[model samples]
Target: MVTRRRLPRAFFERPTLQVARQVLGQRLVRLEPEGGRLAGLIVEAEAYVGSEDLGCHARAGRTARNASMWGPPGHAYVYFTYGMHWMLNLVTEREGFPAAVLVRALLPTEGVEVMRRRRRGRPERELTDGPAKICQALAIDRELDGHDLCNPDSRLFLEAGPGVPEQAVTTGPRVGLNSVAEPWKSIPWRFQVRPEYIPSLAEEEQTP
Candidate 1:
């Protein structure tokens, strides 16, 4: 049995950029009702800083929809996007900073069989490699919003996992945001797993 270690609140009460870069290779654990456990290796993430970041929700100040992002760190900031999918973000920085780290991708590890079923016939490569895809693969949704990431009792939390060495991690510009101006948009904040573990979706068809 794997003993999960919930990350301390202090871990998240820092700069979002630092959290985003450092969160690579951490374990994202989900506790099931049947006392079962599901986990995956965090492979990709992006940082969004306060109002200064035009791409961030905080740019509009603390609205009802984004109030959680303005709260203390170590909280989940789940939000719906494209009227289709829910994206999971981990709030970071102090109470007023309003920063977060978007968990962009994960590599299925524990509970892969369960994840495959949840994917509902998606290809393995598409299983847990993107934000929406990972939420689907890991069964994360709006109900999990505002949950405490530092609480062991929370349905979703993080833990220490296999370390992805610096060499195995790659940094690049974040996906889907081309409008933001220089420096911020060009910042290589997005991190992904090395090419090896990332599956080749082109080579396989979805299994039904």
Candidate 2:
């Protein structure tokens, strides 16, 4: 349903904060193993900058767990969090920069039944509302870590959707950053589209 192609590498290689906001209306597409495509309009994302930024995982420096964040831009940095759910981050800020944008929510756009199955019986709004929840509903996991989102063959890819204007986005402190303090905690790095802009998963009936 997107008129434009997947966002190019140069698009994601820019400043982390810009990428976070720009990704708001993009469509994240997953090529399922069963020969189907499932996608969602990215509704929310958070920017995590460099080591100096306490809210970033790189603040503690690179370990085996966060090495992907240091790799090329437009790569997936999937990781497990809290021993339960996996969170998906799109590595940004170019190679060696170690910055990323955590995709926090999605508005279902395609393959609604596939997402419903993956997410069990959760309500449509609750299915992909949080970082971990989006990961679960999209079948994203550690296996996709470091996957190049710029490559079409990759199971995960991003497509251009309607542009969300600055006025249509709401900015606030990044979520789940309670442990971090001061300016880092207060930076308005979190970006989300207006609630009314989120479309339902129900597709229009087709005429065969």
Candidate 3:
């Protein structure tokens, strides 16, 4: 078992880009109600800093849906989109400052059987390769919106995991924002672990 230390609130209270970069290779664990822990290594994430960034949810100002983003650091900021899918984000920065890191993809580690089952036998590659898909695989929804990720006793939390070297990290523009304009749209806020550095199951083979 990977003896991962739960990340502290200070880990998230750092600058948005730093949080996004450091999050890669960290463990995202969910204490499943029916089984043991369902966990995965965070592989991709995007940073949204403050209300000035047009792509951030705070761009439209704080509402009931995005209030969590403006609250304490190291909290879940889950939101529903496409009328059906849920996206997971981590709140960053000090209280009242709206900065967040969107977890874009994960590489299944522990309790993959449970995740595969929840995904209804979808191919391993599709299991948690997208933001909405990760939520589906972990059964996260609006109820987890304000959950504290820094709490050791929480059902869901982040932990120190596989280390990703600088050579194995990549950055690019955040995706799925075709409607947004320049600067923000082109900012290279997306962080990902290179394929070669990921575990074999994630890139070299299909999930069985």
| Alpha-carbon lDDT, every model | 0.80, 0.86, 0.90
lDDT of 1 by residue, 53-78 (tens): 87788987888788889888999999
Q: For candidate 2, which ten residues in a row score worst on lDDT?
A: 199-208
Residues 108-167 of candidate 3 have per-residue lDDT tens digits of 877788889989999888899999999999999998999999887799999887658898
Give a tens-digit lDDT track for model 2, residues 1-208: 3453888899889999999999988889998898998888888999999899999999999999999999999999999989999999999987999999999998887788888888898778788899998888889898999999999688798987776777779999998888888899899999988886554212211212
Q: How close is candidate 2 to the true structure, as a TM-score?
A: 0.93
TM-score of each: 0.88, 0.93, 0.94
RMSD of each: 5.2, 2.6, 3.1
Better TM-score candidate (1, 3):
3
Clashing pairs in 2: none
* Native-referenced Cα lDDT, model 1: 0.80
Ranked by lDDT, top first: 3, 2, 1
